[model samples]
Target chain A: MATVSVPRAHWSGRRSTLASIRLAVLTFLADPQWLIPSMIAPIVFGFVSFELFLGTPDLVVYVILGAGMMSMWGQTLYGSGWATGQDRNIGTLEPTLSAPTPYVFVVLGRILWNVVSGLIGIVLVFVVVVVATGTVPSIDNPVAFVVLFVFTMLTLAAVGTVFAAAYVYTRYAGFVQNVGEFAFYIGTGCMFPIVILPFWTNPIALLFPPSWALDALRYASIPGYVGFSWGLGWDIVGGVATTAIYLLIAGIVFKRVERHVLEVGNLQEY
Target chain B: MSSVPAIEARGITRVFQSRKGFFYQDVTRTEALRGVDLTIETGEIFGLLGPNGAGKTTLTKILTTLLLPTSGTARVLGLDVTKDTERLRARIGLVLGGERGLYNRISARENLRYFADLYGVPLAEREKRVNEVLEWVGLTWAADRRTEEYSRGMKQKLHIARGILHRPEVLFLDEPTIGLDPKSARETRKLIRSLLGEGVTIFLTTHYMFEAEELCHRIGVLSRGRLAAVDTVAGLRDLVGGDRTIEAEDYGFEDSELAAVRHLPGVSKVVSEEYGPVTRLTIRVRTGDLTIDTVRQNLIGHGGLQVRERRTSLEDVYLDLVEEEAR
Candidate 1:
């Protein structure tokens, strides 16, 4: 495609989509029934971590923070992308496409809410875990943890984009949600740590960017935990590097599949 | 020249490949468009007339940048479809068949406003444009009702509003009035004519021959993926030598006499099909001027021949094209 100047009138498309995404996230959070349960999973796990590492005041905080961030990654995948898949299935795909807005912005707008929703889920879990358990981990490497989480989230977004595009072929976004949930369970260690998995399963989990991220978070924030063997912060460095690579790969693959499916006139056919 | 054709196609072609379902083995490739070349100058209503599977929808998709052509090129308002797709899409309006375009869950007003925003209409200008288009399509009264609750005609009217939300320079409407009642169809037709008056270039496709004849400045008859004919209504009618078909009750001409009548200097085709006790031969006049006298004199020479009916219209032109392709 030839490069052309963006139309002046549509310069705000990115902002519009982002705003819509935030609104969708806030709206979902506004409902206490959903908010309470989704947040509880991480805090309950944090309490267990606090009990296991007695006298380590920060263990509870680290586990809760890691779990909360990890849950957000899951929300970005299933929350935003799943909603887009529903629109595609219910025959709103063409109307959305007919608009003059760039396809990228449209897709982004559809799930912008998920990013907000994911953040809300994370915050709620953090507060509950801290207040209820009285656990506060010292901030040893807050910047590093933030960097790792952001990269991990981007990797999940790439996966979500591919899964949503694939929905065009599969005709079911629910399947993407199911796949994303399964991925979250194994890759993000929602139930347990990467070390607990079998040696072979570790490599499989490592394929996803989140595997190293969770390890890096636990290693950086928790006291006396062996995070990476290859020297100072190697796990954090390696995890970031691995996630960047996964994101690049996933982005390229998703775009290719989307183009192929759309060109074949099957984009909206389903 | 205006530097903008409302619509233009240069050697455009689209091919569709069919895949067999699981457990089946037959896969086929169907060519939906075969090198169709066409242009509709700014401010004219051009009708693409064809039967089902005639590639009209494929062409519409290419023009709207929804489907890329297999080969060749198309442009809407000087923007190449493949290259400046985003900009091109912003300027063009398209309405596909039936009530598929409108969102059933939202009220008609919301649907129009949603599209208005998507097209990048400024927040302030959006309301004005939305209201103008809604009133133009006469959907203001039902703007608040969910589209699903609206009748088919009302939904179609809303679809038209959604297409023109941004005042697109060129519009493509495919079979806009296919299933509407006569009153609704007439109202929509009148609305279209008014739009044409305002200099909106329209590329329309319809199965209704009369609608094309009544609305189109020029019509292209597509058949089996090729341009069967492209001309003004009168020009197309003249293609079959301006023939006037005669249908009658036992205007008894014997078989030998019918065969003799087929040999006339100006008569092009002599189709003998069963019609009650008599047979019907849809004769085509090969010459320019076809009067009742010319047809009468030609058939009078045959002793038992009699003329029962005569009507000259675009249907004869369409049938002629279809019959010529069949042969």
Candidate 2:
């Protein structure tokens, strides 16, 4: 249109997860308000638990873990799904889906960014708990605690991939998630240990990968704690197995979701 | 390059079903596309013209690999659009220009760069290509500005920039100049013409008749989800009677006089319309043998007769073809 000085494109670009992550970072930076709303629940959970666990330094660790897990549940677990929902809102879903790169990689990039933001939420909860109690609860193995903590988030991510596919499957997924988030929290024993819930509900809780992953994290962080088969070995095995299955489910679900959306021709509806 | 048609479609139809009401019991099915068959050779500009509800966008989406057809098949760059979408997507570009389809919060450069990644552009070439497309669309001055701040014309340019960023062999543009200013719209047409030098086949759908006549190598008229006609400008004119129009006006025309004009040697169709106290008769002439003087002589006794002759236009041919299909 103007004086032609620009060159034509060739082959476009190779799909790179790094580039997707960079795009996520840039989008978040541009719209700082996105992180604000997702932060509210974790902070409230932290302070509420801190007040209940008052005067017991030993019990205080659960508050921090609960708060952090709350952040991880919303951000790390379902980040990619909500990001897909956001794509629908912005009307970028059709273009991105029409692109050469697989949509899974785009969701993966969103999940990775969500993991970082989830960690930020964890930090905020930690600060909230420490300031509320004025005492820092101690952990015996900080390295294992941290590793298991991140591992739990990764496990949640595996399950999150399926939910991301759900977002692709329908635009109403966010509403469904909102209606079911509390049920999910209770099922996964996000705040309280699943052991305290009805014994018959263990199977339902075990369906969630984060259930096993979070229990393992608590065992590593809290002292004299016993949850879900009472040891870390089975918890890790269960977490890994469930995470792999969820990851597998994510693959199958994505293929079907893509097909469904294409057939329905509703990618542009939102 | 391969000799296959850049785009080929056969019996492609799309029907959308939606459920409404409180219990979602009502089912409504809309057949957006009927059996449509089309082919466009490499490096050709193919314009699809239709009114509002004419399935042009539906046909375009099927060819672009965005939506699946309810029946039949489509191929772009020799790959099946339904089965080989990923592969076809790499070689084709699409511009669905509107207020949407952009990350509004980010800068235009950021949006292009993100799409470059999605399109799988090489790392070394991404920045250069983004800059190039920005300059090509004449958005170089506003490249770093956020898209939310852009005017509709600027955003339209950004859509074009993204569509051409990947150097697609076939680019499908859906109303690329809808909201652009006169100067910008002219520049966009110029840009579209220049892409032909690089062997890009363009499939454009627009409501503007002048645009189709100006840029299309061949054009298709779609009405009520069915294609009425597809031909070159001259060929299409000939399809609807002829390329010439003759009009005769008077206080009124007797049936015998109208019959006399219709029976004239090159006149194909004679239709009459009343304008207050005047009756205007339109004649579609099929050959040069018919002239105004001959028509007036045929209408012998008519008083205050006015006669005019002019060449037919794409709009005239398009309306005739579409109205035929609508019937």
Candidate 3:
């Protein structure tokens, strides 16, 4: 046999990351099932809150933010976490995981796309709330609101990555995802203030990254909302600190889980 | 440099655990590969031939770094598969036979572009490389068609295209021509030949005896999770020790007639199976000692029977090795 040497260029992790993100986006666009539910959940919640609040501006703002964030939670759990199971089902997981690119980056890219897709639902819900109540919630700190929103999305993406890794070992990933979607909604106060719940649950809720992010978003978006009265400075500190902590934990857990999966030869298992 | 083997396995083994029953407390372990060692020098097309469940695919997975060995080591391009998985993956490619791996909703071009990106091909060359591969696989005309719309043969071609898209130094192909039509299988073989000409070391696993005999410079036969034999096609045929095969068809044979044929000199084995009205008798005998004429005369002495001497093929060698291992 003849010998031919093909020139190999250095591999760029950033380029592979972008490609994974693009593939995730294209896959989501082609499959409307995930998008339909993400949009409908917020719209339905917005309509219900519109009637219950009787168009009161303060309560309407609460409902809009709650429903919008709830949609994000759903998208993260199903679109990002449960998507690992979908990849296994479609037989693409092994190939994607075995590629030269880091599997963690591929997963991060996927969660990033889910965050982007979830934004569509957030915007649609905001539109529905404004059109129904004829009131746009006044923002006390637009800059803080944007920063907290980004923080919340990233925190959720990290959480989704952790779940994606955990789901690799279980055959009941879909069931787990369904349970997690509702668990985060209730645990993080996406539908209502955690203060209304039992006092003992407050500390647990505060430990979750999304809860702090929600609190920050609520404080920045709704004037006089009952959270972090100290000001936007504390909100930023709390949101960023908690998000960083959650991301740190998620990164460690995901790395270990990914190694276990590859070592055990379970990449093909659903 | 040519002395270094492109692929090498040292006592590689893999075991899978399965849960049994509803409570799931019970665990059953199955050994897929049992200390199997293999080596393929650079630019050689090495074929791994085996029956289903013979650990061929498991070994391929280990060599490709898709599965870790249970208690052994494998290397590609001189890099340990376990220790240098990421770097090893970049230098080698794998094409597992099936239509399931590719993204079904995306066009072939899109799929190839995505994999090119995953392989970290430079942005400037991604499009050119994808197009070149598509053209090589003869799928440039259907490059934009969704893979779900492709035929099985077309999908197999696309699979090959993806495998070679990265221009890896080694490529592992598991049953590349499986389930393909005769013409498509032929085309795939031709593509494999062309790839070999380019100096890509191919580790191929297939059930097709003729394909392995023709394409592989050397072939390895695996049976029951172990390497039964590894040699050139002709060398393997020599394992039967110059045994000649005689196939005869007759309208049902009496037990006494079979016993008479079995007791003949130089006869090693006689296997008879009923195929509708006629019973086919396959007889193996020492070469140069038994001729079709003598065998036909002996059978005809009892009753008129049709007999033909058959050429020894790779299939016969494979069966012989497998049967020897079974004993």
**Ranking of all candidate structures by their TM-score, best first:** 2, 3, 1
TM-score of chain A of each: 0.75, 0.90, 0.90
Q: State each candidate's clash count.
A: 3, 7, 0
Interface DockQ per candidate? 0.22, 0.45, 0.65
Q: Please state the CAPRI-style docking class of candidate 2.
A: acceptable
lDDT, residue B262, candidate 3: 85
- In candidate 1, how many Å is residue B319 off? 3.0
Error of 3 at A256 (Å): 2.5
Tens digits of per-residue lDDT, candidate 1, A208-259, equal 6666666776666556665435533666666667767755654675556545
User: Candidate 3, DockQ to 2 decimals?
Assistant: 0.65
What tens-digit string does per-residue lDDT give for candidate 2 at B1-327?
557878899998889899999999999999988999999888789999999989988898888888999999999978999998888898888999888999998899999988888887777888988999999889999999999999988898898899988888889999888877888788889889888877788999999999999999999999999889999999998898898999899899899888888888888777789999999998989887778899989888866899999898898888888878977
Ranked candidates, highest DockQ first: 3, 2, 1
Please report the candidate that would top TM-score against the real structure: 2
Q: What is the lDDT of candidate 1?
A: 0.69
Q: Candidate 3, which CAPRI tier?
A: medium
- Tell me the TM-score of model 3: 0.93
Point out where model 2 deviates above 4 Å: A1-15, A38-41, A55-57, B249-252, B273-280, B299-306
TM-score of each: 0.80, 0.94, 0.93
lDDT by residue for model 1 (B1-327), tens: 375676789888888777687854677888999998998888778999877898998888888887889999988888988778778877778887475655566677876766666777777777888889888988888888778798988877887888777777778898999999999998888878877755678899988888998999999988877888899987886786654565422445667667765776666666777767676666766564545455566556555556654545787787778667656
For candidate 3, lDDT tens digit of each residue in A1-270? Answer: 566566774566677768778888777777777657678877987776567556555876777778788888888767776677877887787777667887767777778878887888889989987887687777778887888889889878867877777666555777867766777787887776666678798788877777777877887788777764455567567767877876787778776776777677777776
* Structure candidate 2, residue pairs in collision: A12-B120, A12-B121, A13-B120, A13-B121, A13-B122, A14-B120, A14-B121
